[model samples]
Target chain A: MKRILARISYDGSGFKGYQKQPDARSVQQEMERALAKIHKETSWRSTSSGRTDAGVHALRQPVHFDTTLDIPEARWARALNSVLPKDIFVHECREVDSSFHARYDAVGKEYLYRMTCGEDYSVFKRHFEHQLREIPDRRLMQQAAGYMLGTHNFSSLSSPRTAVVDKVRTMYAIDVLKEGNSWTLRFVGSGFLYQMVRVMTGTLLEVGFRHRRPDTIPEMIAFEKRSAAGKTAPGEGLYLSQVFYEEAALQKHLKTIKKP
Target chain B: MKRILARISYDGSGFKGYQKQPDARSVQQEMERALAKIHKETSWRSTSSGRTDAGVHALRQPVHFDTTLDIPEARWARALNSVLPKDIFVHECREVDSSFHARYDAVGKEYLYRMTCGEDYSVFKRHFEHQLREIPDRRLMQQAAGYMLGTHNFSSLSSPRTAVVDKVRTMYAIDVLKEGNSWTLRFVGSGFLYQMVRVMTGTLLEVGFRHRRPDTIPEMIAFEKRSAAGKTAPGEGLYLSQVFYEEAALQKHLKTIKKP
Candidate 1:
């Protein structure tokens, strides 16, 4: 049995999300199906660092799977990409020890949210962007984003869809940068709850547009209730950027990965 | 009446083309309808530098429209963008002299054709690119492109759909640049015939892929017959980049540009 790590990218528009479902399309299902074709009935299970929602995109999503196929590591990428849909691609694939787990072994996750303060997006970029007609104040958005960094009880800023008993998460940093008619929010965190990024995006957008006070960040975090945060931003503008792992720990984890 | 020149961009995946067709959803038809809403009860004439086929995209397609409404020139861009579909946008609008014609008065035109030599494209960019499983040789393609530069009878390299009687035209230059998995063919010319760009791209692709030799270029030009060139490339990978005009000519066109 050999463990493998793959860096993937996908357009999640037609998917239910990253996880498998009984009757829906998903990144995991597609990846598994592609792997099955290459391995020829070999059982394979994939674990990802992030399970983004439908319509969200991924620039650098990392996943690990275990298989007993004898193919060389170099052939794995070409093999998988040959069958995967054009919207999903494996950028890099390599063999690793069996102990690596894509999700449990992650050290950090980074997400990016884009906001366009215009009526329309660049024709070529429409699928990856969400257009908002109202203009937002950049300074206020930046101020609000700054307060969002550090450890916080983010119960109020996370979606209620998931039952996360402990809502405390450490946000290493949050940066809101503006350029012309667009704004990008980069979130670096140890981990996140369900829809946490989108919820934070919405709150910051409200602050930028003057609908909420910049100081509302503290109250919202302290509230520890869903209603205290802003609305959920649209899924189209979100992207799962990177999944980081400690190299020393990763090597050990890869040894126990399962194979057919 | 005022004449205005607008720089527009569109994802042609949803439209029949840039021209207005009686029963088809066209970029022109949509823009006309949207503009008519602002200039109620007024019929306006809009013209583009050229028609881009369905599924083709544009980065700087120039258009001219005549109107009699009283809206400011600066507001025209935002106003039209608001009513346009998410895939199309009016990037800028400025009053042009009465004599300015988007097509006839242009001094130069730039077009770009993108092709990917990979199994899959970046999910966000799939719609804007054409995938070619067989990688083409760039050096050979560049040699063929070199033969295509300068004055020539392009009738042999154009599609039968072209409506022009004169086949002699000058192509200032053709630049083939490769970036990672994608190859971009950029053409600068005085003008292009109907389906000319698509056919040119096809012939170049054929040569690049070794289906034909670079020497075939001069032969095709000498043949001066439409059947001598390669197949027509798909519209999905083409873009009308920009239109250029002389300052004096632009001034004359601006005077006739309509308001609102």
Candidate 2:
């Protein structure tokens, strides 16, 4: 058996979520349906690095599947794209060893949360950004982020319904970038608990707005309860940017200052 | 009765077209429905600057309606916006005399046609651009635009289904601006017939690709037949950028050379 890995980008507004449910539309369902049509097999399945919530977009999500067909490796993307809807695109695909697991082999992941504090909401950008009525203090948000840069039990920053038994995770870096009226928060972590990124962003935004003190982050983390954190930011503004399987690639992904 | 004119922007991918039809979803239907709900009248109607085809977005389309409600001038936009769908946004509004009309009083119009030549199609841009596989020459397109300036009967550039008897229209300016891989064709004219801007863009592209000569534009217009021109460009890349009520504003819209 041969395993093939495909990197895809999706506009998630048209889907309910990335994971498969019994009654709702999903990206996994569409991927499996395209595979079934290609292989003429009804029980075909695929495994992804992680699942994104409803209305969350992705730039480079990877998935792997085993098949018995003799089609060329590069041609898999074109063949699958022919059957998939326009909302999803398969841009790259390659063959992988049978021992490679798409989910278990991941070493790091990156996420981007975009928030905009414009004079008014934009019609064209209603699908991809969190709109705020007032501007937040970038310095306060940066100060709050410094407390979350190391290993900790993130029980306060995750949903209680997450099925994981261990909530301890390591944060590699957090970058705050501001351009015009929009602010983008970049998170690099070993792994994320369910809804962790959104909760952290929500907490940091509160700190920026002066609703919470930046020094409160340590107590929020040590409380080890979900109620200690701020609200979970909406899924519309969250994006799964990349998944890394190697330490070298993860280190290379960090942003470096440029000399003009 | 008081007349109010509103400037709106919409993402047309969610609607069938801009005109009101019996069965299909339309921008007109949504606007009138929002008005009806706001005024408690089922017979509210509106008139627009012009009609756009299906999948054509608009940045600053204007519309007017008469109402007996006592809502303040500035608050009308907020009231209607409260009920309108997210895809359509009302950005500006003002009170006008009853003599001023939205459709018949228009003096000039500007439309933009955006096209991109990329190595592969982008998934995030499936709603707004015309994707091309090969790059077209910019100099050839500019040379062809020279034939389309000034007063002339643009019969070949309009659709045969246009109901207007007088097809003579004055062309003021045609600016072809290229930034990176994308080309923006801006058209400023006294007025346009049905599908005229799209057909003109399509013909210029054919000239850029060497399928037609630049000097052939005169003969194509003199032919007085729609078949004499090139293929009709799709509606996906077209945008109703603005409408002008005065000659001075129209002249100011022309492209001016910048001093670096």
Candidate 3:
């Protein structure tokens, strides 16, 4: 058996989400369907770096699957892309060791939220960005984001339905950049709970609008209640930009999997 | 009565074309529908700077319409945008002189064609660009484009179905710019014939690929036959970027229609 790791990118407009559901369309279901066609099997299971909500796009999503078929790693991307929907694409594929778990081996993640602070909405970028009528004070938002750059209990930022017991996570960085009439917020963290990034962005936007002071961010995080956070930003504006793993661990896995 | 001129933008994926047809969904039809709804009338007519083919997008398509309703110029954009579809946007609207014509008074036009010379196709930009596996020689393409920058009989570059008697036109400039894996071809001209820009781009691509020499461009133009030129590029990759008009002429028209 061979383990394959594939890097993917998807529009996410046509998908319900990344995880599979019984009836609704999903990225996972579509991927499994394509794999079934290639492997000539009824079903196949795969593991992803993480799950993204409906309408959330991905620039680079990693996934792993075990297969017995003999095919070159480079050919796998071409083979799968032929049968997959136009919205989903596989950019790279390579053989990996059996011990490399796509979810467990991940060390960090980066999420991006895009917004257009223009009075007139853009026709072409409507699907990719959230539009606001007035520009926000990005400097204030940046000050508020500084408070979120450390270990904290992110329960206030996560969805109330989150089932995880440990809500503590380390935030590596948060950057707010403005280009023309567009604002982009990037979040790098050890891990994010369900809807955590969206909630954090919404809270930062409130600070940018001067509705909340920058000093209140630490208070919100310490509250440890979902009600303490601001409204969740829309899913369409969020993207899973990248997934990070330890280079040394990955190299060791690759070395063990090489043919003697 | 008031004449209104609006700068419009649209994603052409949902539109058949810019011109109105009997049973097809065109951008003109959508604009007229929205205008009728605003005017509380059953029908309305509008004239655009020019017609764009089906699947050809427009970044700033200038259009004019006559109305008896008394609405402020600045409010027109807001009111019309409320009724227009999500894919169509009215960026700017203002009162113009009745003597102004959208198509007849235009001095020049600029069209943009985007191409991705990358192995992997972009999911988000699939509707906006043409993807090719091999990278083209941009320097060679630019050399060939220079031959097209002058007054010439463009019958060789236009569609055979074009009904215009005047085939001679002046090309102000043709620029081939490359950025990373993307290539953009900008065509500035006094006017373009049916499918002229696409045909020009195709011929340039042929030169870039070394299938045809750069010096052969002048010969192709002088051939005065549609078959002499290369194939027409796809409509989805084309965009009407801007339309130019003589400021003095527009000012004179505006002054004539001004209330005493």
Candidate 4:
């Protein structure tokens, strides 16, 4: 059997989440269903790089599965897309080493959180962007994000439901991009805890609102408590932009991404 | 009661069509439902510039209604938007002259049709753009469009179900914009028969595909038969971009619209 790694994209509006669950519509369930049809009587289990929450979109999610079918790389994408729903799409597929685990082999990840504030927010993007109740100060948000760079115990910025004890993670980059009334916060890290990106964004927004000071971020991270951070941003605004396997490929892939 | 004019926008994916039907969901039904709640005892009837077919979107569709309520122009949009679904939106509102009628007073209209050819089309735009099976020659398409400029009998370019006796209409502008793998065609005309824009786009695309010679366009217009032209493009790719009242406003408004 050959292991196939595929780059996928999906609109999360119609899905419950990325994970498969009985009686719930999900991206994984739909993908595996397509795979099952192509594999004849055999069942093919797929593995993803990460699990995104409901309403969270993905532009380039990587997934791997083993199959004995001798389909061409380009034909695999075409075949899979034909059976998959319009909301989910397979962009590219390639044969990979059997030892390459989609989750464990991932060296880094990148997430993008979109936000719109004030009265001029886009009506078209209501499902895709977080609409802030009040306009926040951009400069203040930028200063607060700077504190989140590098290695730190980000337990305060993760969900309390996260059971893993190792909270220390390296944040390689944090960028705050501003355009018109909308802004996007991009995060590149070695790995993120559950809801880490959302909580970090929410905390920085609180700083922008002047409810919390930029210097308070350090103490919040040091406290290692979930209560130390602000409210978590909505899942609809978050996106799993990329999953990096090779450390050298992170910067090269980032340059290709454009502003929303 | 004052006649209120509003510019509306909607994503047509969830809607059956623009007109009110007995059972199916429509944009007009949703708008009127919101208006009925605000009017209390009295019912306000709305009239649109044109009836768009199923799955057809609108960027700036002008609608007018007579209302007894004394709500401010700004508040009118806000009030309606609050009651409407996320797919439909009220962008701008104004209290127009009492004699103004949405359909009768309209002098001209603009329609935009989007298309993408070959394999590299955007996956996210499946619901919005027409994905052509084969790549078309753009230069040949442009040459065919030139024949469609100025006043012509467009009976061959509209649906056969059209009841209008006079099919002659003046075309002010016909622009074909190419960007990457996708292309957009914009049409500004005095008036269009039902499905005229979509049919025209299909005919031009057929020219681009080399299925029909560019010189045959004038003969198609001369024939004045529905079978003389190419097939009608799908409604999903069509948009009612603008409805013009004042003759001078057409050029001014056209300049403001950006490419898809």
C-alpha RMSD for every candidate:
7.0, 1.9, 6.2, 2.9
Top model by DockQ, which number?
2
lDDT of 2 by residue, B1-260 (tens): 99999988898888888999999989999999998998898858999999998989898699999999888889988898899999898988899999989889889998999888755776667788887879888888888998998898888999999679999999888878889998799898899999999999999999989999999999999998999999999888889998998777776666342111
Pick by TM-score: 2 or 3, better one: 2
Using TM-score, rank the candidates from best to worst: 2, 4, 3, 1
- In the range A142-233, model 4's lDDT, one tens digit per residue, is 89888999899998999979668899999977888888877899999999999899999988889989999998999999999999999998
Every candidate's lDDT:
0.83, 0.89, 0.89, 0.87
Backbone-clash count (model 3): 0
| lDDT, residue B248, candidate 1 | 54
For candidate 3, give the lDDT: 0.89
- Residue A144 lDDT (model 4): 89
lDDT score, candidate 4, position B189: 90
Pick by TM-score: 3 or 4, better one: 4
DockQ versus reference, model 2 = 0.73
TM-score of chain A of 2: 0.96
DockQ leaderboard ranking: 2, 3, 1, 4
Q: For model 2, what is the alpha-carbon lDDT of residue A110?
A: 91
**1 versus 2: better DockQ goes to:** 2
Q: What's the lDDT of the predicted structure labeled candidate 2? A: 0.89
lDDT by residue (tens digit), candidate 4, B158-247: 998967989999987788888887789989899999899999999998898899999999999999998999999998898898888987
